[model samples]
Target: MSLTISELQALFFGLFGGLALFLYGMRKMTEALKATAGSRLKNLLAALTRNRFTGLAAGTVITALIQSSSITSVLVVGFITAGLLSFSQAIGVIIGANVGTTVTAQIIAFNIAEYALLLIALGFLLEVAGRREWLRHYGMVLMGLGFIFFGMELMSEATRPLRDYPPFIDLLRQTRHPLIGILAGALFTTLVQSSSATTGIVIVLSGQGFISLDAGIALIFGANVGTCVTAMLSAIGRPREALKAAVAHVLFNLGGVLLWVWFIPNFAQFISSLSPAHPRVDGCSAAGRRNASADRQRAYFFNIGNALLFIGFTPQLARLVDWLVPARAELDQPVQPKYLDPYFLSDPTVALDQVRLELLHLGQRTLAMVEEGLNAVTRGGRQRLNELRKQDEAIDTLHGEIVTYLGRLSLQNLVEPQPRQIYEYLAVGSYLENIGDVVETNWVTDGFKRLESGVNISTSTLRLLERLHEQVCRSGKITLEALEHNDLEQAREVLRSKATYNELAEQARTHLARRLVVVAPSRLDAFRIEMDLIDHFKRIHTLFRRIARLIEVSVSDSRKTSKSG
Candidate 1:
């Protein structure tokens, strides 16, 4: 039968509307699930195994809970890119992801569309009016589940008219050929960018008696291959390991499809034989019964195929994928924050650990700046002075990066100890940045000015300044060590030594003023410069001491928290 323009528009409207609700509900459900188990999930992902079976199990459980294989694969790619997972370990996760996606198909097959509206109403009330945050999140999960079924209901109703439509019947006939059905499945999945959606649609059509078991099976096979698109897209601009993960996903699906393509009819027969509730293929069965049978059979077959292919070929497949995406030669990049991998941002603990490591690296770089500044002043050379200035700039750049990274970390819901650690890191970074500024702006600039003015410091003054600089440098090194190792005693010692450095500075100043009077009148400029340098060394020591105090406080707080716990 032919339909009017309005009927066609209604069909399109229903189909698109259903798809919109379905996608939105899936997103809501996925996000709520993640938020509910955010920390636990992060820990699980972080603890991925090199063992294929363990990796597979982890991937399956995570993806099944989240209701998205593509998401799982993307996470795997990110972890691999961050050097958190080995290439072989990632292969198993990708393999398991394919199986986990079948959970959606199984859920759809349960045929719970009748309760969709009631779920929506209850979910809406709980989400909008519930007082508790967790209750609201639970309501969102229910709302997502309702939306998914409601959308499917709408699409199923719209497509019912096509049961009598000749053109649509002919298209269903074409899908009986494995190649045509496979292509159709791939195209539909690619358009929606979700294999689950494609599989749901297939179940809908099969229930309506618009498609046969063989065609449905073919479509499912193609959907598996099509789902790889999401992981592949995620790999773009990522590291070499990420690209390998994407390639592994593609290879797994492609290999599975190519291996099973010839057995389409046999697979269909196998599914049909195993489905106890499968309705007769004749046109006598009700659409609901037909769909129920079709849904279960497809879900079962999808699970079986993924399981068999992954389990049997995991080791060989891992090797093949590794060979296909060989590791590239390492690039000679500048020394920067290697552990600041963006992927770890999802796990606050992991992210914080990385940030702490980068901060330690920053501490080392800043110490280098201090050394360079001392050499620049003591040796009286423009080359060392210019290098010192450049190192200071580098330190400044690193400090800015660290501050920005810490700011991003602050946006996350951090645990108790995390906030304290973050604050301590921030304070340390600020102090180091200030120390770099002093070394360049005060020491380098003033020393250069003295050189330009032809004012040479007296030998006695130089010796005194060098001794103080050396002491400050040693203290700075000790403070860094204390911070890095969380050495409470060492930090305390650094704090206690501050008074000694202060007295030394005072004694040096008194001695320098005495020598100035005995020196020639023209040497007054040099004497003043010497005193200024000594004052800067005292200030630098103060900054270093402040860092030590901050470290001590952090350690003390950590101890108290542990005791209370």
Candidate 2:
């Protein structure tokens, strides 16, 4: 078991150097894929539904592309918190994430270590000299693949000496005990913060003749259990719904591990049957053949374990999580965007979705503020007037946050239509804020000033203003609806209704002017009050028109981009 200082240094170099390279490769590959496919992935995730099968498929696709279940789980938690996904649907995606993660093990099992240098050279040439964007991204992927295999090869060589080391052999034997093996797997994955890395390392060890099939399967079980740590840490301080999603992830993995712990022997036997030459058999002569079988068996073991857990426990797990985490009481909560998760900003498409949701919330809040201001004007309630003014502060805060977040997203080299979409969101946010200011500053303050001047609006003038208020409220609702649904037809309707609204305002103004002439000379200030209020309503209408127009332009851009793409 004794080793020279040089030997110890080599071991450390091989293990740590290979691990660092592997992690770096994984990150680069995932980031490149995400940059290339960000929008498609965003759309797929955004379209997640209550159907378990659909969620499962979406989860698998996303995780497979990104090469990290942790990222997928973080996304699922954020979506759940934002109300984009239900607890039940998130469970299916989680299952798919587990299944998708197994793809890494499968890829590693190919044992293409000898070709690593060739891939590295090709990848470097394309990455450094390619003229196209796709060429560079694909080159990055190639480079990452090369680094991964090269690192695995190094680690395999480094650990080969362990086959003869007595102490190391004793430690590998302890892994034959399921509990000991699972604990080792969990502990190592927790430290690495990646199940795939831990699993890959175990496969490398297995291929090097340092671990048996049953021991490898036990370690795989532990890796699954340990990966939950990432999701749990992400959920801290997040919304209650997000916390529940994290809990469900932990629960699902733990339950599956416990259920499968007693059956590792049976599962290992089944995996061996599927292999060309069982690990227990002595007929296999080629080192490559033996290593390939071991690696493939480990991969299959990981995949099948997840498949069975998801298939058998999805329904029960869904129900159990729901019962465990009930919805919070929805009281008279203030109007705000429930789903504006800043974590989504990493993906511009998802971040844009968050902005859209936040803008919708801003619109809803603005509408409420307008309604209260109108009530104050019509009913002359001082308290209601103050409440509307206070609500504007919230509108301002949300507006600023949306703008800042979009600005951050814009800094990233976004894909087609995204830069245009950022401008649209900014325009919509500005318009929404203007509407709030109109209600609080223009309407309420002006009404108070008119009152201080001893001017009381005539009954006829009040009725006209009420009708105009109704029109403005309707316009706000329509604009919000069009934006939320991204309905081109609805946006067109909003555009067409502008003339009708103008006509209505013109008729009301003319009628008000005539009424002003008939008002007593002592009430001359009433004329100014009524006229100013009408002008304010017109300004509000103009802002809504701007929002509706932005919506229209965004939809058009989206169509053009889709066609071109």
Candidate 3:
């Protein structure tokens, strides 16, 4: 018997519509989970990954909570690019992400379609009526869960009529060939961009006795391979470290699938033994609760086995990935924002973190310029001053880029503290830019004027100036370090050293003031240049102090928020 036109319409609409609901629900659930977790997830990954085992555990917990291995992989890539996580450490996380994704299969395996509507109704009520934001987030989670099960129910019903259709049954029988099943599963998952969807569909088919246990096992294995595409796509145009991480994901998944492809029957039988037996119904032994259980057990065993096999060889895997994805030389080019990935803009927490990293990069560049400014002024000629000016230009360019990036970020739906944080980052960027301007416009011009006037500073006065310059540079370095690490203590140190810097500036001024009475050619000019340099150093130190205060406020706010939560 063949499916009639009316029956075919029902099948097509039911399957496609159900899939749409499933995918939408997964997306909503992931989004809600991410919102609830927020920056804490980033902090967790940073804090927990002391070694490969801890990193694996972090990866598993994070992926299980978010319900998306792709998000976990992207986070790993971001951390690697930010230099927060090493490539070797990220390899373990990547492996554990695969293991974590099996949780979705386990979830869908529970026979709860009958209650999906109830869940949807309750979740809707809570989402609309809840008084707290977290409550709303949980409501969304419940709604998403309901949609997933309801979708599975629709898919199951859609396929029920196919049981009597000989041609469709013949097509499904071809999946009993492991290679074909793997190809089919991989291709479908790659197109849909959700291995969970493919897994859900395979479970639905098994529940209706449309595919054998071996076929379902092979398809699940293919899902492990197909899901790597998300990581690969995210790595496009990203740093070499990100590319290496994505490559590691592909190697681990594909290698595991190849290792286990030939043993599908044994894998299925083994998982079947682990799963509870379900009685045959309508002459289909695989048509009851055991169908989903067996499929989920297979996924669990496969991913866990792969993780165990690969965890010991992370160093080797990292080396192999490094070899495959070699670093690009242009990645070291100056004046470009390294951490401001547009992909992160969708998640404001991540986007803000990227901004913070970029600010650190900006601070480092500005600090180098400050260190070189004094050298260009006192010892070097016009060419050296011009080189220092070019450094200022780079600083200006980067500051502008940061401002523009922040502008874009402001357009996002920012939550509490993010708006304030953006303003603080903007202030810091402006202060750093002002420091560059002082060096370029005032200090460098004074150097040029002093060079043209044939005025030379006495060795003692130069030494005093150099000491003040050294103190300013020290403060700048400390401030940048504080910003990089978010260390409140370092920010406080910069704030506390303000009086010392002021005293040094006063001593430099008095020393330059004394030189005004000396009788020498261009003596007055020398006094003026030295005095101006002292004032510029003081101004730069003041700017550094301003940045330190901003860091202090930002860090304090973060601690308060963490505590409140």
Candidate 4:
């Protein structure tokens, strides 16, 4: 008999609503885990990608911690864009992420739908009643797990009627064909944007006796391929490294599936032998539980096997992906912010790390301007001065981008010391920008004035200014190194150089003072220009010290915090 309208509504609402809960729960769980482990995760990913094997382990552990391979993929892409993780290292992580994602399917296979409500209630109580931040986070984790299981229960209940529905049974029978099952699985996963969801649904169908183990295996294979869409979408408008990483994900998943497609029956039989039998009940049966177990086992086997197959070929794979996604010519044209990836803003710790890297980029550019500005003022022609001025414009553009990115970062829900870190970065960015301003506004104008008035500085004064300029540039470079490596000693070294710079400034002033009396044509103008240059260089020196001091304070605070923890 044909189903009535009410029955159809029940099925539609239950399935869709369950999916909504599942997605929301997954999101909630992922967010809570990320907030709890964001800093450690960043450190782990950065430190552990020494080789393919370690990278694979790191990827699997991180994905398991957060329970979302999509998020892991996003993190990998962001790290690649920031130059924290190389593309080849990211490929290994991508392989491990596939294995990590199978944990969700394994969790779904347990016979715990009956306790989903209890978990929800306890999670709610803990979330509302707990006083500590971490307690609340754990509570959310529990709630998220509850929602996932509850969603599966809802889906399972909704499809119960399908056991007797002739049309539905016929459709499920078609899935026995490997290609048809794979297609359906891939399409559904693409629409949902979650392989776990597709896996969950497949388990539900198997439990209800709607699909056999062979079809379930095919659908699981397809889900692996479809899940790559998340990584690909994230890589859009990102750097070529990110695109290469995404492409690697696609190749690995698709290749693994292709490797095993023809062995579905054998795979199914092997998985069946490994999985233990489950007793039949009113809503679920031995076959259903067995199929669910087998599907999850198959995922583990598929991803781990693929990781082993490709782990040794990472260098080759990276080369192939690089060849596939060639670099654009415009990569070197503009001075855009290299490390300020918007994807990282979701996790403030990683976002702050990106900001630090961008600051290093900004620091290098500003230091170059300082060195060139000195040359333009003392020994270079009008053309060189104009070029320095243009370079300052680029500095201003980069400074603005850093400030805007930090402003956006400040809006995030920052943890302890992160708020202070943001302020420090803002201060450092402004200082670096001010150094560029010193070059363009003060030093560059002084150069123009010197050129226009035909003021000729004696060789002695030029040599003195050059020495001071060298010292200033050296200090700036050291400060940048401190910032880049978080080296406390380097920061302290910059601060300690203040006395030496002071002596040099005093000597330059003394030399200029002695020149004022015996000067020839435009002699007074020459004295003023040299004095102005000395003063501008002193100003730049002071800014670098200020930046160094900020680094010193930041490093000290971090050490203290670490000790306290």
Q: What digit string (tens of lDDT, one per residue) describes model 2 on residues 6-47?
A: 888999899889988888778778777777776777578778
Instruction: Assess the local accuracy of residue 29 in candidate 2 as a C-alpha lDDT between 0 and 100.
Output: 83
Which rank order by TM-score, best down to worst?
A: 4, 3, 2, 1
* Whole-model lDDT values for every prediction: 0.77, 0.78, 0.86, 0.85
- What TM-score does structure 3 among the candidates reach? 0.92
TM-score of 4: 0.94
On TM-score, who's better, 2 or 4? 4
- Relative to the true structure, candidate 1 reaches a TM of 0.78
Model 2: per-residue Cα lDDT at residue 478: 90
Quality of model 4 by C-alpha lDDT: 0.85
lDDT of 2: 0.78
lDDT of each residue in 291-327, candidate 1, tens digit only: 5555556645665566666766766777887788777
Candidate 4 residue-wise lDDT at 255:
89
Model 2: number of clashes? 0
Q: Please identify model 1 stretches exceeding 4 Å from their true place.
A: 48-50, 70-74, 279-288, 291-323, 326-364, 371-373, 396-435, 446-565
C-alpha positional error of residue 337 in candidate 1 after TM-score superposition, expressed in Å? 6.8
Local accuracy of candidate 4 as per-residue lDDT tens digits, 461-561: 99999999999999999999999989999999999999999999999999888888993999989898989999898899999999999999999988997
RMSD of each: 5.0, 2.9, 2.6, 2.4
TM-scores for the candidates: 0.78, 0.92, 0.92, 0.94
Worst 10 residues of 3 by lDDT: 278-287
Count clashing residue pairs per candidate.
1, 0, 0, 0
**Highest-TM-score candidate:** 4
Worst 10 residues of 1 by lDDT: 280-289
